[model samples]
Target: MAVPHLVQAVAETRGLGTDAARYWLELLALTAPDDRLIRELNGWTGKDIDAAATELQQRGLVIEARRRGATRTRFLPGGWMEVSGPDRPMDVWKAPHHLLWEDDRVHGMIPGCPQVVPPAELYLDVWERIRGGDEPGYTELRTTPHRRKRR
Candidate 1:
């Protein structure tokens, strides 16, 4: 399984549970460059911040990159894509809401918040960008050679 920076942080810091940590990761990924800064800015103390940063580094999500004689930690990307539903990729329209209504219910927030739902046209626009047209198709090739069975 791919390790997101915040998932490792959550596991190490012990501040937020998995779900809350995932949510915070998504939110922080939009703005923060690294998990350590995000945790620190969110009020995590010395040991917790250090542990979370160490966890992120250990998980391979955070990496030290050097440029112009300066080293910095940055998320490596890819793992940040948190798909809304099943493990397999699905059409955006077909997938469940990014967060379920039950999440709001448990957290004591308003249920079925329409403001979070983007219009159908937005989904179609994104799909068009991905599919390149209305035609339903995808490329496939068998990479492995067919092995002969031993008698």
Candidate 2:
């Protein structure tokens, strides 16, 4: 079955809304290279994206990676900082939410990051862009390729 159909089927079997299931699938897609369908599905405003990301965070499925220059900080649920400090100048809480996932790793809160590209593909895009003397800055791509706990 196609991805959408498969997701819908499994969701129905589990008594879950297909839309929610599809949305999470779309979120997972955001971590890899982009496709036309993924782009169309992700056309929501930043606010909508943030709301969905918040939902994922609440589910404990992903964590946020806040970056500034050469420094990066990861935040877990409940606004807990991976590194402790009251004087950390970055107001990550107020930043826009974006997620990047590749393989088993999920990264969140990358500002200005676009939706989905596989880590290897994204790295290649970045490399090619740099080779052409262009800043990669989340260049879009096409075609490609999550966690949880039991109850």
Candidate 3:
């Protein structure tokens, strides 16, 4: 899937790469119509805040409002950002080769293949699944039925 135009536009405007833009967009979406106080935040000067607010307005992602003599910024209607990407393999983090168990059960075995496939990739997938807390295998194993079966 091709990356969405909104993602690219935001990335370009914010000077953040596509990946960081994706994260920031998703986070902004959660804020809805709430006004962002850019200047009052720590580590941000008024000039930086004004520049960011101007950029956001120019991009039509946000609108500037004046309330109680203070300028505020909020997302425009239907300005929610979305990101997409082509289906491609991504590198997965894995433990070193030496850390993996030597047992045959830990390695994936293919029928009619004498070689033992290293489980680093598989371990990465399982680790990601567990970290996400929604993997089917992990869920099943967590359920009482699976525990009973194992017992």
Measured by lDDT, the strongest candidate is 2
TM-score of each: 0.28, 0.31, 0.27
Candidate 3 overall lDDT versus native = 0.34
Residue pairs in collision within model 1:
none
- TM-score for candidate 1, residues paired by index: 0.28
User: How far out, in Å, is residue 137 in model 2?
Assistant: 26
lDDT of 1 by residue, 19-100 (tens): 3344234322222223454454455554554565455556543344432211224433222222223222212222233333
Task: List per-prediction Cα lDDT, in the order shown.
Answer: 0.36, 0.37, 0.34
Q: What is the lDDT of residue 96 in candidate 2?
A: 23
Measured over all alpha carbons after superposition, the RMSD of each candidate to the real structure, in angstroms, is 16.2, 17.0, 18.8
Residue 147 error for model 3, in Å?
A: 65
Could you tell which candidate, 1 or 2, scores higher by TM-score?
2
TM-score-sorted candidate list, best first: 2, 1, 3
lDDT of 1: 0.36
